[model samples]
Target: MDRFIWSNRGIEAGETKLFSQVGVRIYDGDQKTSYDDGNINL
Candidate 1:
């Protein structure tokens, strides 16, 4: 699962990208978030 939560300016500056991993965390100069999937066995 790849996701980017940024403003339009970010996209305009080529900030769009994809990420793959069993479990990972993301931060966009704000609150810290994590990617959790109990079904994944990684």
Candidate 2:
């Protein structure tokens, strides 16, 4: 499995929401992988 850190900035409210979200893909060479959906469609 891989690890990642995602964030949602530019949100109008402090409450958690799906808008303006960003994803950081942390790759593990042992496992061949890449983003499959959403904005990070790698």
Candidate 3:
């Protein structure tokens, strides 16, 4: 995805590109406890 943003055939004129940070969480079987939490770049 980052490669495409840097390529010549990138976003068109008058267009916009947006990036967001995503978060992930792993829950236990009970669903009441979170085992892990992390952030990822999409």
Best by TM-score: 1
Better of 1 and 2 by TM-score: 1
TM-score of each: 0.26, 0.19, 0.23
Q: Write the per-residue lDDT of candidate 1 for residues 1-42, one digit (tens) a residue.
A: 245543323224544445434544555467664533412211
CA lDDT, candidate 2, residue 26:
36
What candidate 2 gets wrong by more than 4 Å, as runs, is 10-36
Give the winner by TM-score: 2 or 3.
3
Q: Ranking under TM-score, best-scoring first? A: 1, 3, 2
Q: Give the TM-score (vs. native) of candidate 3.
A: 0.23
**Per-residue lDDT of 36 in model 2:** 36
- The per-model lDDT (C-alpha) reads 0.41, 0.44, 0.43
- Model 1 misplacement above 4 A: 1-19, 34-42
Residues 1-42, candidate 3: write the lDDT tens digits: 122122225457886767534465544455633324544233
TM-score, prediction 2: 0.19
Q: Which stretches of candidate 3 lie over 4 Å from their true place?
A: 1-8, 20-42
Instruction: Tell me how many residue pairs clash in candidate 1.
Output: 0
